[model samples]
Target: MTAFTRGFRLHLADGQVLDGAEFPSGRAALVDDPEFGFVTGAVSVEELLLGYHGARIEWDDEALLEGKPRPTADSITSDQLDALLLKAARADSTWATALREAATVADGGRENDCGCGGCDTCAQHRIGLELRRRADERDGGRP
Candidate 1:
């Protein structure tokens, strides 16, 4: 039970909710739910609207169980940076070559009990798949 400096109840798009928090104590377990996987840092409503990770955030209100809420970040996260890299891969000169050599293979949609597009498995999962695709290409189809 690490003391969290801030907390929030995340309302997913499909009626599921995930509660989380940041540990200024440097050891908050609340933010890393086994069900929701791992969520680090703070995100604002504006950034959530971008669907950058395929999930919308409830920005109208917040549920802090401990500390004050911080505003949206002034910079992008490393995951966001990776997403940008993947996006850039789309426009790269070798895209056509890579596509022919290693075209995408869909995972047949969500492979979970809740596939309504709200759970971390559904929302954050897309980012993982996309990143994996990028990785496969970068690794010359080794994966």
Candidate 2:
């Protein structure tokens, strides 16, 4: 059996501890954590740590089967999902549609909200009622 190395571990807000591992999109055999670590994705290690603290998502480091991505907001695209749907739509449409819809609901709430860093309705401010409403709506009531 293949052995794995240990890497950065995160203590999640929900009392779950996740370890970082690396894999090539999981089509091959499963590997232990520490091979790829969490640095292989667009989201940084700090972002994953913060997500753990913020309770937005949860993950683990157990050897994953093939096809399990690095697990991040930008890991996959709606188009890729659409393609998969096109291929598998006939299998079951209800759960697949809901998965696509719910999984994609957080797309617009990316890190581009503060593009200018000078607007009155800046990402930080949200002081006024309108700004707060907009921000809340934009995040899908997540925050």
Candidate 3:
């Protein structure tokens, strides 16, 4: 059996506490996954923390699983776990996609409304108003 060298505990807003053991092997297994994060918007420890908080706010406190306390939004899900693993597994693909996107936006062009500090297309600028209009519609005409 493995002995824990450190124990990490997170006190969730819903009054549930998440506890996990930190072993050398576990530390060695920790890694980052981007597509998992991009696809789900949950790629980092902080992102996971925020997701747990969201879940905590969404679920009832009395829920339970297999006699153990169920996770609120504050609890990490198997989906998130799988996302992490998937991100790790598809790291190369994600990198390639990112590179391709970067190349498409090639630097030294111009600037967009948000000023991403990159070049922009005159066509893009001319159509910017229409794009914003559509965005406004999508946002329900909020400012």
Please, what is the TM-score per model? Answer: 0.23, 0.20, 0.23
Task: Report how far residue 139 has shifted in candidate 2, in Å.
Answer: 61
Cα-based lDDT at residue 14, candidate 3? 66
> Model 3, poorest ten-residue lDDT window?
57-66
> Considering summed lDDT, which 10 consecutive residues are worst modelled in model 2?
23-32
Ranking by TM-score: 1, 3, 2
Q: Compared with the true structure, what per-residue lDDT tens digits does model 1 show for residues 66-122?
A: 132343355436765575567666555365445333323333434333355565556
Which digits, one per residue and each the tens of the lDDT, describe model 2 over residues 1-143?
A: 11322244455566655546333332121122345643334234444444344542223423331234333445557765675556454444444444344433433333334355654555333333334344444444533
Of the two candidates 2 and 3, the one with more favorable TM-score, higher being better, is: 3
Model 3, 1-143: lDDT tens digits are: 12333333445676765543334343311112333532222333344456555333221212223223333355758975575556554664555445434433542223244354332544444344444444444444642
Candidate 1: the clashing residue pairs are none
> What lDDT is obtained when candidate 3 is compared to the true structure?
0.41
Residue 118: error of model 1 in Å? 62
